[model samples]
Target chain A: MSRKPIHRLPAWALRTNGAVVLLFLYAPIILLVIFSFSASRIPGQWGGFTAEWYATLFDDSRLQRTIAVSVRVALVSTLLATVLGTMSALALERFKFRGRRVFDALLYLPIIIPDVTMAVMMLMFFSQSFSLLESLFGIGLSKGFATIVVSHVAFNIAFVSVVVRARIAGMDATLEQAASDLYASRWQAFRFVTLPLIAPGVLGGALLAVTLSLDDVVVTQFVAGPGSTTLPVYVFSLIRKGVTPTINAVSVIMLVASLILVAGSVGLQRANASRGRQQLRTSGGNS
Target chain B: MAEAKRERTERRRGFLLALPSFAYMVLFFAIPLIIVLVYSFATRTSTGSTSLSDWNFDAYRKLGEPIVRNVVVRSVILALVTTVICLVVAYPFAWFCAHQRQTVRNVLLVAVMIPFWTNFLVRNYAWRILLSEGGPISSFTEAIGLGETDILFTKLAVVIGLVYAYLPFMILPLYASIDRLDRRLVEAGRDLYGSGPQTFRRVVLPLTMPGIIAGSILVFVPSMGAYVTPELLGGGKETLLGSYIVTQFLTARNWPVGASLSFVLMAVMLVSTVVYFRSGGKNL
Candidate 1:
């Protein structure tokens, strides 16, 4: 609001530096998007534009199968994670117990620990557990689809709980109390009052879980069985085999999806913030 | 009697709500961590398979081997370089973002995150393509009279990929701390007639230390144990910790050594994290 201070000069430098960094962040993806349409087989050279790679993406049964597996894993794990995480958040946020702090830290362990450690441990445990099962019960659980889903849920639940718990911690307690005062039982209040109020948080948590599940690679790699490769894993294998324009096409699609999700999330947050402000304004006006 | 009944009900309700997640975490996360810890002590036979019998500190001892030692050193160095680069590049941007008006800040933050949420492999793969021969970066370098570069599979490529991949991790935390900074403290510092650099050194840096450490840990720990980036970019020519541990398990079939490496990596992360928390990075 005041005239630009002597300090404001470096602010321009800061903004320029920020812009450069952002451009660096985005330039590769933009190149990928542009090159996705190149008819050239090589990712480097640009031929005439074509949608050939997108067509290839649809026809590649291997890529399609991996996509299917990733979707299935993401869907199942997100669902399970949302339920489990919401429950944990509810218990942790809404109650007090002797070991509450300890339990809360334990719940966050998965989020703090690196992905590789978690993946390797899960891989070791599942392999041993499967071998033990094969010996004792004559049932074998392979390290592909089932393991990936379970492994995903194991970490996904923790992330979901963090998101949902933050939301719950900010929520007003008196609404549930009012519901109980209106002759609603505790279970009924939670089901009808608490659930609806926290639906946004639950949805946000589920969205986060979906992204985390899809973005996973290290854990999925260790536990993936034959024919159970997820998209990221498949992409890694593709990169190893040698990158092609097809990878560019895949990268373009993923970039678009991520951009959409980021936009949606930012929009949702703005909406939520505005609604909270309006509620505050109304309450203050009443007072 | 009524009060006792009410306490009992609340306790039961909390237990019922928490049961499924608690049990699942115990079965999958805690149990596997214990299994890995136990496996770390097991003996690796000449055949590369670990024998649970005759468990000792052999694997941990093997961590001193030149090969393992080199990988640990290399991974830590790479992680440190990556963390430093991320911090330097991210600090200005995070400050810029935090200083912007609310709407602009929101938009900028989302733009920064879009790259992160994009598939990690996809982003790294894009870099490989860009760094490969005739790629955009290569062409730019050539046109600038810097000459052609064959960096795709090299250690330099791995660092570039790492800095790009984890920059957001650094920026987000820094932004959180900067956004929470009280403008009056900054104003008071400026009123003391200290130069911008001096004020930042004396006031801002200390205030943002928590974010600095948190971001460094977030970037450093994962970069030390990185897989997708180095694997995609390093071309397996250099053995970083992530690939080395994977090799120990999947290829070399040496589970004990792999477990030891994993435990060591986690131990490093845990120590730094604890240090950060103790130093007032408590919002985690």
Candidate 2:
């Protein structure tokens, strides 16, 4: 393969630039991990290495509880977002509609809107409508588990829809038509053909939803009640008191979890893409 | 008759499948925004209950106040700075990824995205430590014969933080566009006696304009409204539209003013995005 003349630039220049960018990105993260193990009470000054921070993290019941709450919110929100987002993607992609473009733009509005604005608006609406909500549905809407889940699902749906819609657009519609022509009912056609075809997109969207919900602070901060604090909120409040190694320990754990989930998602996408290619080849051969 | 019934059933199934998303948007997205719009016009009582009153443009008028105007101007400027920095830094990185082999590209892309998965607040706080007086960054600077003054709270730190946080947003779209670029075009330009800069200006630049616009919108909009980074790194000296709105409601307890400010912020962002997209010749 022919290379561009830019490749003729001194090798050290390219290597040095790339290294600087990478270091700029990853150095703080590395420092965070290292400080988490430092015995020093201050953040910048590193003493000897110790596991005291991890032990301290375990000892903090409030942090533990907040983690549990965040997990619950992330799990439920991811599930809700995946289901709604997949259906929306299918509809937007497969159906011809008058307002399809409008719908698409509107769906993405939440994602583009600033989180602070969305959070405050959500707070105002829920608080103002609490009585109405209770009278109508026998449920009170306030800053709590229910509210957090709703907020997360609302925001995550946009991301989920975008990812799934792209995948749906890339898929061939003829397979579903062929399945239906074989005397399969609509449900069977969807199950046997469309669902599997879009499963990778769904998984990718769900993984994103989970990561976003878990990492959220602003929206969660606005909607969480006094009794319901997620990990990020707890950490934010903790920082006001001053930095601690325990916070770093928590960050490292989150970092590891996110890395695993992202790796899994990429692997799944590759598998799906290869499968799609094979299916295309076989269909072409038969035709 | 059976087939007709089956078709009807299929239509119903599609409607049912689409219902959840429709309801989700209507309830959370549409209604809350409607509430904000109404609150922008309504009067906020001493007790904080918003009520319909003689409709007034007082909130809109408040948008012109010096404090509000300053915050708005500052936010826009900061966002523009962040966007430009992200583009400058991300362009080379995206180009690098695009030229790499498939495996390498995937690895690099994953690396770019991994930091995004971590809590943004956590990452911002990491920068706090990095820029503090005794932090690695300061130490490195001092070691290189630069002064060891604290950089944590300055506007410089804020820009660095914003750029680092949003660089991925700029990189991803550029990578997608550049990855799809036809290499032959560049070769053809070179054969026509075009220099490196000329080929980049005429061919690669115009081709990636759409990606640049998309990435700018993604970075600039959020950077303007970003509270966590500025608040953490700005050491309470720098205030953006976001922190201002939050302070109005939470600290100041002026719900009407907060509601009004939030609406103004939204309006500014919407107008900017529309203008940006329109100027880029893309359909919103």
Candidate 3:
């Protein structure tokens, strides 16, 4: 009996379509990198090659300041979001309680809602109720780094919780059980067993949170004050003025930095997954 | 005795762990949203402070104006177009990835994710260069004897940019669903005298519909409010709801109108999301 080769058709079609899709996804990025070093003042003009744009970026104090601010915000927000996110993940995944679905949905609301909406809402809240916050907390909650951090954390919580929850759900309960049976305290069991198991997920979430905090423009624009300009916002202002090679240089640098972070995180996650699998295999063999 | 103490301590620790996130969300997320709801009714004072004395549907009523209506309709259409394009492109690619070897799948997934790591503003700007009159695309076209023309500021460019930016969102969920599918189902369909297309339509499509719905929501909702892509690519000649609201708050200084526009956009998104999840709840 001869079978008609239907599978071959799908395989061929997938390959052809996949290549076209990849091209569409990457062409803009490739063009950006190419134009960065084109040495021409005009975007499409090829006037030989030059390193002038990179040099100009280095000398631009304003851009540097904006980069610094963006880094600071991303750092602080990542730290705060990671800690709170991990805790929230633990609570939601480990415990069952009333209104759990509502809480879960509430946690995810920020991720689904457009950033601009969140930004405007935060602006309305801070600007309109300055006096109320001042009276309650002795500090005005207007635009600034503080506001950006709060907004970043608010959005990041959902991501972090989801990632950590997945890790928790996939984790083996026997490890914790074994630790407890070995006379370890509850805190000790968590610290040694559960924490280590969930650390990769938390780290992955933190990396994502950091990337988002750094690249965010909409929410940052609304909440950031006069002195709180970020790199993306600065780039936006620069583009409105005109397209300069200096902006391209900044883009290249951001691309390089983010690629490094993503590669590092993916590597770590892979290593953790392999190690977890290995541990499971060894345990299975021993049993 | 020890077990009882351990249980008590664990309970205390759980609450302690949860407190920080709860407090932060309450203060920032919950309160800001409430403020938006309140301001949707109250009047804006001459001094720029909002007064709550007059609670009416004035802002909601204003949404009936042609400009607001047009922006809302345009936003929905643009989002729908982007979602359809993303799904069409991403589905086949995701299916390819899912069928590939493990190493190949991992590499392709990373390739898809790497673009997202770049600055969104920078990526949009890059598109501007590529689509501008003197850009590579135009130059290539001219070299091939096609006349030079600017495509950068067109609505087509905006749609392209939106699709590019959100394609990853579409692909990832599709990959997840497709990868989870059982190959035996296809084989079983073939055994029952079903053709390949029939098997795919009857079996595979239904199984993967959840991923399609999730990916559509991920792409469409965000694209509806996309400001950066349209602003950069459309050259500000056109306005979507996001850009309109941004201008209102930042440039126009019309607090009531901006707040109202934002709420309306939110309402549209919420209703769509509710309808989508309700219909797609089983698969999701």
Using DockQ as the measure, the top candidate is 1
Off by over 4 Å in 2: A1-15, A97-102, A133-141, A276-287, B1-13, B45-51, B275-284
Itemize residue pairs with steric clashes in candidate 3. Answer: none
Q: A92-122 in candidate 2: lDDT tens per residue?
A: 8876444556667779688778898898888
TM-score winner, 1 or 2: 1
Residue pairs clashing in model 2 are: A143-A225
Candidate 1 scores an iRMS of 1.9
Each candidate's fnat: 0.70, 0.47, 0.59
Candidates 1 and 3 compared by lDDT, better number: 1
Model 1: per-residue Cα lDDT over B43-91, one tens digit each: 9888777789887999999989998899999999999999999998898
What order do candidates take by DockQ, descending?
1, 3, 2
> Which residue segments of model 1 deviate by more than 4 Å?
A1-9
- Is model 3 an incorrect, acceptable, medium or high docking prediction? medium
Ten contiguous residues with the weakest lDDT in model 1 chain B:
B113-122
Scanning candidate 3 chain A in windows of ten residues, the lowest lDDT window is: A2-11
What is the per-residue lDDT of model 3 for residues A1-287, given as tens digits with 9 covering 90 to 100? 85553344556677888898888878878878888888888875566788788988878888899999999999998998888888889988876544456667778778778888998988877786687768888885557888888788889987888888888989888888999899998789989889988999998998988888877888988888999888888888778778877777888888777777888778977898799889889989999
Candidate 3 lDDT over residue span B222-272, tens digit each: 888889888889888768889989997888776777788788778767886
Name the candidate that leads on lDDT.
Answer: 1
